[model samples]
Target: MQAWGYVSHQIPLLSFASRLMNKLLAERDFSGQEICHVLLNCELQEGTRVVRAVDCRPYEQQGRSLRLQGDHDDDAEVVGIYEKYLSRPALHGELTYLDFLANWNTSKRDGRKWTRWSRQAKPRVLYYFPRYKSNPQHHQYDDFCRVKLMLAHPHRDPNELRKINGVEYDSYASAAEFCFANHQHPDDYYGTPNAEDRRPDPDEFEEEFHEPDLLDEDWLELARQLPDCPPSQEMVDLLGRRDIDIQYDWTPHVGRYADPGIVQGDYWRQRIAQNPLYMDVEDLPSEARDTLNAEQRIVYDTIVGHFQCESEEQILLHVDGGGGTGKSYLIKVLSSHLQKLARNRPSPIWRAAPTGVASNQIMGTTLHSLLRLPVDRAFTELSPADANALQNKLRDVRYLVIDEKSMLGLRQLSWIDKRLRQVFPARAVEFFGGISIILVGDFFQLPPIANKPLYFDGPLKDLHEASGQIAYRAFNYTVFLQKVQRQQGDDQASFRLALDELRGLKLSIESWKLLSQRVQAKLGQRDVDSFVLIRPMSHTLDPTLPHFKFLGKRSRKCSGAARESCGQWRAL
Candidate 1:
């Protein structure tokens, strides 16, 4: 291990970040309660006990920080706490916490609360976690940054970034990372230089590096507006509601470097359910490929062929299976084919899911929420705000795998169709690749929701028909991952038997057992969940502009944390 000298604030930041990250992965939570317990103990056992519990990000020249993400001064009830408590160095990570006293002066005043608008306001933190940032370079390591930090854990109050076993300490722990890809690490030393080692090469850039420009207004404004990082529960609940799976990535270890670089002018085209999943032909086997029946191959061929082209157009795929069938398993398997085409790596067909739970499957939004349209108090069909929001994020996605298509109806089918058309010109454009939409679900398991379905009465009559224009052309491509997820005993025997049994009546396979056994020793439970929520990364940066900056990471995309691409921002 390299010997350390002192606990410069810069160094403490990284070690603290790494330790906290380790806890987030290990304990699966970042709340002060959970984090503080572990980090504090670790610090005490190791001996550093000084800590400053401030949570403010320097937003102004004098270091005034604004309310983090959710609290909005735009709303009134929360104005008091929002103004006083929100941006302070620390405040329970919320206006209030369990078993704690309320801190706002907007007390009952006369016992009875006032109006409806007043009820809407509260001193609660609004959470906003970004689902996916374009991850151009996650596999490469050339852009990693290093800093020092102490082992401390964060509590809701003073959520410090580092911690030890069960105590709180302040002395620096180890390395931390700060990134400025396209720029290298600053040459200035934060504190006194290491005494043992002689200064390296030529003119030391002593004056060149100093405290990071803490008063950059643009930088501060962006930080103030960054969507709040949502808690895990919010994320999981959202995805589960939409049937999206979830996964976490914590490899970078240090602070900002752990996740991929997300710039202001960008938005994620898809979710990062997991590092793209892959499949090896060696493991899948040619014999296995040969054994697939014609009907099965037809499904495979259409789906497998989608990636051969490059476009942003729309495509819809539908697969039907019976109860007990492995629709989800099949979705995963088929995803491999698409995954191979999506990324340059040899990993299996990747189905990048979302970190944030979403209401809508496509863009990590919710359903009822996404359905809001352009009608005001006048009445509209879908949510224009939501659609526009989605457009910016999903404009570039080429492949779409909609699991549970069997549960879809005509209205949804039409809504999605029309939406896709609106975004791209005649599907004939190669740049659109006729956006592929794969619908996988066991119709036998359940049918589409009634009333609002395509098969409903009223204005949606043409929607529910099997002979309508949509019926014939809805899913040009379809495949059934007929194999179940958890096929216990004899997989081949059971797979064949299950299909044979359902030959007449609807049937399905659950591939959980087989899948678990297949990668049990490798990936635990699951890492990548396709659930997502998206918003424009840069309110100012246009979606169409080509990559404008580079900081770290290997690829041109801003990734990792190096010291480059410093002056990349331009006012829109």
Candidate 2:
């Protein structure tokens, strides 16, 4: 039957038959014809039926004729011996002819040995298939299968395994042992088993499977399973559709799992597309240019000059402005102009702020988030991979507008300088990666937290000098926005005078009296509903009033209602 099977498949077996006959004739002391009969019809059992020798005479005649061809001379014997095993099956030690055939077919379908099969099956075993296969009564057997899969998968997070299978093993060691005893090696089988075949139907196992909540813990667990690279645009969009709120702090972890370049590129591309910053110079909106006061116009002109200059000649600019000046408005104009110029390419203009709230006001991201700097460590301490990602992100950035610069520290600024230098090594001698940087903030508004301010001129300056760090010296141009666009007439003049006096620590009695007049009397009987009372200590005020309190704490309800009433109230 085996000989006929080979013949029907058109598989050449003349050489194999010759080698078998020759071996039997030499080793078993049997004639070539007897060997042929044994191969074709012998059952190798006493009293079993066997075919008559006459039926196998054809095969014996062919083998004997080939052997006779090898008897003439030494050269003929050598050639005949070579031809004998030329088409013979290359079976492994102790493996049968059937085993060799099965292995050959498997190797043809998949290259290499079972190594590839083991690797391809490992992830599916641990991640795709559930722990159990049969009914709940066969839970023990299912546990054995899961444990076997877990053993095959290296770098397996125990927590992830438990979460995926919805079962926690007492320990990895115990799980490994259980798998060893119950699960058979894949090599013991002919082919790789399908994960679905080993797993019960989804409907049958739905009750056992619990979907994890989309919480931080689950996100972290999922992140652990992902490969270290930036995610593709599709993955990011899918995540957005799912409304997974990936926090800024989690970016480093998430970034490693996906391709950072793709994520950041797609993110910024979408942001620029959605932004209203692409206007022609001639068609610049009146709101951007006409609304600026004289002081703001000068600051705007300086920023425009920097943008218009050759990239190599552009200088870092600092726009010093108090609370009421239109600094934010100027930044918008500059951003729009630059973005419009580079609409065909990635936007050269980028905005960042120290705080999330401040960044949100300008439709930008936190500086640390933009830089991908670790919150717990300095920017200089970024990992090599993170530093490369940061460099790639800033490679095309030409203009960076940093709002609330006062809150940024001298050390942080130096770190920024160092990182920029690393990104643009050719321009390391230049300031801020040879990019036009506009720092917008009033130095007197809020000093840097837990560090010396950028403008500090005391021992901090000496410390900076000793550390070879550049401070405000990096700014080649400075423009002050002095016009108080938020207030007008006596209110504006009086407020300026009070601020100046307070800054100089020389508040005169006249200045104090001028401010006190704005404070309404708390004890007096007043129509609180008709007019808003301005008290120094009051947290809540009437919603109809033009003036709002700027105490230490914010009254969300009162402020929200007042903001809703006016529809245009800018928080002081």
Candidate 3:
């Protein structure tokens, strides 16, 4: 049977072992020629051994009553091979003969260490209690499966094993638990090309695939801005019959991925048609269209999607510009559009900024609050609990929007990626998916307090390198937003001036000196013509407020007069 290695991770341990045994046995065999018979299913009438060598078990004193897997004693390599099949570490030599060790036979071990399964039989759960017949403890506790029981055990031929094909698990929740323990998922086995027979029942698939439910607080206030959805009779029925929830992708609500071509081709033929907002891209008002400048337009077009869905890697929405140039405005405007996009689909979204100061304007909670990282926490792989909690909290959201992307540090970005992939292993948070992250900020602002600036060097760079795994995770994915819409036609001149300086776009040295001194000096007549740094703040209040917690005490020299008139800054 065909199976996706990744999704199979969600299956339970027992089911996993069973499936592993079946798949491994079916794929390879004891005899090279006989194996081909097993593969074809054409020579079923012939009696044949079901499986080849099993992983090892050594005997006491190198002598057991019988040889195993056709070896005279025990074949160390066969046992080692079994471990490798289970993805367990393999031993280069023999499995250290545990039977001869001092601890051997010290206690009555109840569980089976090695077992062989048969078709048409309930798995014979092997158990080993010491073979002490007349021992004092044997009288009190049942030590073995007595002959009475063994004699009654039913027997079946090897052909019956083929009947034990796919597992018939009871519940999706149970199946999910099994899948997780096995480090696999149902999706791995269900939709695989050769494993169609193993697919979950439609009802179970629905439960497994649906979008996660949303929390009441996750919605933006009064954000009922429905997307531009087209109406259709089939969609009307689908929406009317289903109790679909608007959720994000990391959690449970997500279903199987649908082809956009199928979605967009006869997309409208369905019950719930396209998103309310997916009409003619050209007819959108120019202001709405221009919100994504030339560069942004290129990114939007390159995304190759209609509405967002799950399973992708890396996402970068770079909105670069100076202050007040409408960078934040574009994001704020798109917030609803984003919400509508996620709401319209089956997958959910998780949105946050990389820093506290920046997060305040966007997600309402602090970055640490969403991440749950302690103040002194060092970045590491998220604990299973942390991963579980994050998955639970982040199930369904359409996108991740980070304000002040420029301030995001390496550790911060790494943390986000690890946490994201842990929860939604299919579509990593760094990747683009149903989520289209919009990063709003200027790179020139600041990097992390613990990381090097994108352009920083020396001390900062070395420190980041020494930070270990957290720093290593930093290498995942990267996106840089570019554009300058924040400044007005003339206001952007400030950045152009700086860019000019760096690119040898020059002004005389005297002009540069005059501009730098503006922060300390009053504007002279010549300075008036240059760019003036204006604070919307009034001149009357104490200047001390500009410095946090530095409000100066009220001072009165019998005749009140301003001690310093003012300081004006100039930029060329």
Candidate 4:
């Protein structure tokens, strides 16, 4: 194989024929040695280009017989021959070598035996010939091609030139034949006196090839046409300019705007018209004076004094109270008094709560809605229009009352303070925009979700210090509503004591036993009918229990009646 490597292409055609003869004999199960002539018919048109392979055959020279015989009138011409010694089988079986060869040839002609050489057509060849732009010698090829093609067809339109010259026919042969009359030399064509006159001027060519200048206005128009393209630099700068007063027409969002149903002017007007003399000091309602407990009276007096004070000092008050301490009743009295005082003018009192349900109970709105504060962003991050709107909203509001302060976080309180400061720059910087703000809630009620509470003195103090925000220090006055007005008598006294112990996280054995007594396991039908279950431990009662049906059905009916009857008994 090594020796044959040097002349591998020049190997004799008889070698390939001998190999084929041996393959054929092996395929036919032949074993003895035999000399045979093999002929391969290949059709070639021009020179060495093979058009197709026509046929193959093996002939026994001594016998003068063809192994694979067929009609000889075909147009395929014999191209070569291969003659060598090949193994042939002895004549023992019914099917001989001749019969096998005949069958194989028949299969090949019938299109069953397909060999690589027997393909009907050759594979297409892709030529990597030199294009005008790629050839270094043809640096000016594009210009030359365009000029020559145009001059050759002088009567053709501009559109026709683009269609035929650089784009349609990219070959140099096409350009030369069309323009130079088959002349191959580019330099000679350019040097010709007539061709020199036809050549385009360099200055004109540069001008024609240059791209158009795109101005800012042009780019803006283009951006408008193509929606996906971002705004250009010039447009962005114009929009970002502070001097441009871009008055945005903002729509009031549902949660951000106070409920129209509650804040309408007609509701306040009706209340004022119904009681024209309520604002007179002599006509003060007896309910305001009689209903308030001792602690609640102190809170009410502090709020009224703050409003009555004519000094520049702003008061920030927080009323610390637990559930059923008359905080809501106090708020109602303050609201009535403030509304009556400002009946001839705009209302000075603005009540807000953190939750919608609480806001509705106080006949006010959510704190976020009243101040137009964004739920997802901080007050400092408000847009110019939003900030201005907030300032206007806070301008006339003199008394701001925030209920349910437990659910509000330190950051939110700081945000409110910041917004107030922005609105009233003339007020003392220490207080909240010179407005008397009353915060009412128990810190232990419900902690703020995902943030630190107002009185949180945990490890997060450093975070508040870094932000330069004060939480508990903002309040100038604090009032405690310690009396439990809702509970009384021996049973109520015991219940209140147990609740206080639970709040302190110190559950006494007696308290646990008192709570456990309410959990009755089994009861008879008469007990179920007579049993008055006050407060169940769980929200869902055990439906499987025998007493559940009667208790569930009668408890709601009895509880309201029992509450009314219990209210009649007061502390001696």
Candidate 5:
């Protein structure tokens, strides 16, 4: 009987209803209160109802005749409530009528009404079952049951009042479907405290129980009190588990939060674990260092000087150049040189780009993936625990290289700034958590999608744009690489000139002609044949390709062998 509280939703209401009715009939001599008590304690599933379509008939054919003979005209009364009162917009008045009828049908009656029972038992049957009264759909199901019982003829067999708990056309004809339509998710009902059963809101709690906002300074002061030695096993276990409640008021730290010291120590421990030895710095290849031109060498030395400087002042650097001017190559060499200097202390340089393709060029991850930034909205502050976790992950990082800087919008830059500030709260006021930032890209390339460009001077839309503006203005050093490194030989001079004109958006007549001559339409038959065909649709490209004529003459039917060869080209 105790299991009644945890009754499976898989059990059909019809089965429970029929079982209750049988128990009631068996205890006919007992008082109403006694029958209620007995039924509440009895084993369920006894005398379970099994519905069959053959047992049911339309009301007009058999129910009307049976109702008139048995004087069960009151059956029409409950069915009228379902159709008429439920349809009215004034639900308060109609529900009052339903409650009165339900009570009237269950009570002892006078004159033509039977004292023991109503001639129509549909209302009485529905009134007896109140186990699922708290379920939101229970009232709707009751009305459905009433309408179905009144419209169906079951040959006076109470167990066969209807075929299912819902309309015949509905998918809720099965028990699983019925439960899904009625009950909430199992986790909502069983895993957490029910809404009605939970404690009052924090505002309602006594003043002493309220949790004050523990500021960063307050957290730091608490951390300074801890001993400067190895953490005890107890501290290690506490740091490892996520479920430990750090905010719980306890002795020796009743007013302050308990986790900040633990989180800070864990962060420092991770940084110290990556200790770089003197012998780890390998000598760079002389050719790699010697290959840099005068312009490239100057930029390299400027960045290296900032890295080796004893001061904590952040180096906000911008390395600007056009395509094929060795921007990517410069970044690679800079990252390599910096890594050698840091000697194996984790990765002192972190590289990221706005796109996967661009990131692949620099052997880095996408900015969004690297920073775990949200794409759909501007960045928001992270929870303390989450910020601490991110801090631990990037503890040894000192330099952040952002490639494809032109594609990075105001909002994304703000996200990076806000995230770094959270990760290193000690330097919250510093730009990018005091880590030197290097931005490298051609400014004329693709701009950020669906957001204002980083250099936009228009009125700021929100805090993110304002923050990005401030961060952008903080760049004190810039290195411009104007010398074209990739296209240097005489054979590429014309193409290089044309690209320069295109990048500047001032293409001349000669440059236009040079670009046009390389188009597919101007290519010779030999050049066309050398090119591979990639189109999936053979017919679409048949007239375009000069080699199509080799397969067959335009006016004639091509041979099967030739057509097969053409089809293979199309597949390629």
Candidate 6:
């Protein structure tokens, strides 16, 4: 491979072929021997400069005996391959490989299978190729830069040269011919002079990357004021309701200058009930409710009491706890109670999390999916049609339980609040659109990414962050669970202490020694089967581990040993 690497221009082609065969063979049940036979039989156009699969210039060898025509199945399979690999807009009406196959008889000379090769009859148009900005002499550096540039242009279309100067060609083929005639690479025509050949001028050095200066302040002061903003009609209607928000205080809404159905309060009670989970919460055993610890009971009772109330007052509560504190257990109990209260109506209790894995644990969806929240950006105002669709989708959702609150960033929560308000304009003034929201998770686990945490204090950056902080602060009550339910046994006291110290980032010598002892311990055969590794991404694990099962009993033994505390294994 290193020997062939010197032919740098062909490296990409080799890599592409390797990936193509790997994917093709993986999809089909082709053995390596069968693949080798296919490669041996297939003609390799080594001298051809292949830019695409279509450019491979395939030709049949003499007396190889061509497959009979009218085999629809084989033809269809070949067509499917072309469609998957070579069917791009540029080749839309051109004579593709399929067309060449159809016209094979015409191209054959005295029954010989070989055909004459020529440039494709494409439309005569101005051709463009990006200027290669690297020195070809330094092949390694140039190859890297070329790969980066190739990746930047994902779509295989010719670019429009902004300044054509005197270098112009009617087609790409003509340009290549001109380059060959001049005994120079086509890239050299437009490429900037190499570093050693040309030094930077004073004007180039003086170039500023900063934004250009704006007009004078007196001119900027003439900037017109934004139009008078007003809340959506639904918000006005919600405020007008005598049943809820009696004061009708229509103060201006905040966040992103933006932006369900169901009635207020017990209006959900009047609607026909249809349970989505297909389970009767009423059938849940009394022991489920009875098993709650004192701390859990307080939160459970407060939530249940609010659900049973006649008023439409929104409940925003946070259930804060550490690991193994029965927070999940409490959520299960509360979900059941909420279900029982809602009766036959669609379970008003919807659960969501910042991530899919966390949501799956509680039989919920991710908040982004559930709320149609934007990724990596602030939420924008939705179109009327989209808002209507979102409203209908979430009409029956009265209570939302968000798990893994620690992973929920300020910007994300702000998006949630903003989206909910837009969707249920009537409840726009209320935090999270007047829906009873229950937040459950340990802050000690993992903090939000690229954004401030829910508990972020100090100075605020922008109104976006400020809005989320305000929404979080709106939670009327909080329940803190301190019990370590999972590792409670006397035998696991040391493990519990270690976990506690680890969470607080104040690990003691005692905890460290306990962890060190485990590091030195060996795993038994039974331990290997029971042990499971958890990672945020599967790619983070050993890539070759999946191959262990295919290597038979010996590899199984190797994998088991690899799982042992002290065992070490590395691929050569």
For each candidate in the order shown, give its overall lDDT on alpha carbons. Answer: 0.37, 0.52, 0.40, 0.51, 0.57, 0.57
Q: 1 or 6, which is superior by TM-score?
A: 6
Name every residue pair that clashes in candidate 4: none
Every model: Cα RMSD to truth: 33.0, 26.2, 27.2, 32.7, 25.0, 27.2
Q: What are the per-residue Cα lDDT tens digits for candidate 2 across 82-180?
A: 122122334322232222222222323222332222332221111112234323334354454433343343222323333323455664444544445
Candidate 5: minimum summed lDDT over ten consecutive residues — where?
A: 186-195
Tens digit of per-residue lDDT, candidate 5, span 1-572: 11222443223433454567789988776566666768798533343321111112233332221222336645422233232222333323223222333333322222134222245432221222212222334454443343323322222222333334433433212332344456443211111111122333445435452322533445589999988998788887787354556555457656454556465778556555776222112345535856887667666665555555533667776777788899888777877787776764765778889999998888787888767799887567877787777787678778788999878888788889988888888898898988878888866776666665666666774778788877876775556677799999999998999988877667899999998887689999888889887433111212212312221332222111111122222100
How far off is residue 483 in model 6, in Å? 0.9
Q: Which stretches of candidate 4 lie over 4 Å from their true place?
A: 1-286, 381-385, 459-471, 520-572
Q: With candidate 3 superimposed using the best TM-score fit, by how many Å does residue 199's alpha carbon deviate from the native?
A: 72
Is 1 or 3 the stronger prediction by lDDT? 3
Could you give the candidate ranking by TM-score, starting with the highest? 6, 5, 4, 2, 3, 1
Candidate 2 lands at a TM-score of 0.41
- Lowest-sum lDDT 10-residue window in model 6: 556-565
Name the runs in model 1 displaced over 4 angstroms. Answer: 1-297, 311-315, 323-326, 344-389, 425-433, 452-473, 476-485, 488-572
TM-score of 5: 0.44
Return the candidate ranking by lDDT, descending: 6, 5, 2, 4, 3, 1
lDDT of 6 by residue, 1-572 (tens): 22223333343444554566789868986466667777799643343332222211111211222445574755322232222223333433333333332222222222234443454632111112322434545634343333222222222222311112356656433433343355422231122324333323435334443422433444346654555577888878786566656665456542423312232454455443643433223345546867877678777666665555533767676677788999877777778777766776766678889998998777778898888888867579899999998898788777789999878877788889999999899989888888878888876666666666776664675677889988877765566677888887899998998888776667899999877765425656676567676443211112222212222322211111111111232110
Work out the TM-score per prediction. 0.29, 0.41, 0.34, 0.42, 0.44, 0.45
Candidate 1 lDDT trough over 10 residues, lowest sum: 142-151
Give the C-alpha lDDT of model 3: 0.40
Instruction: Please write out the lDDT profile of model 4 over residues 1-572, one tens digit for every residue.
Output: 11222223222422444465779867984322222211233322243222222112212222332444348754433212111111222221222222222122222322234223335433211111121232225555554454334323422132343343445555633544455554343121112222221223345323332322423445578878875876788878787354543565335543663646357746666666887522122234736656777666666655555455533456576776777777887788877776665667656778888889888777778877766666785445456787688776666678788899877777777667666766776773755667878888866566555555665443444443323236345564566677777786776977887776665457799898887775446546776678776542221212223222322443221111101123242111
TM-score computed on alpha carbons, candidate 1: 0.29
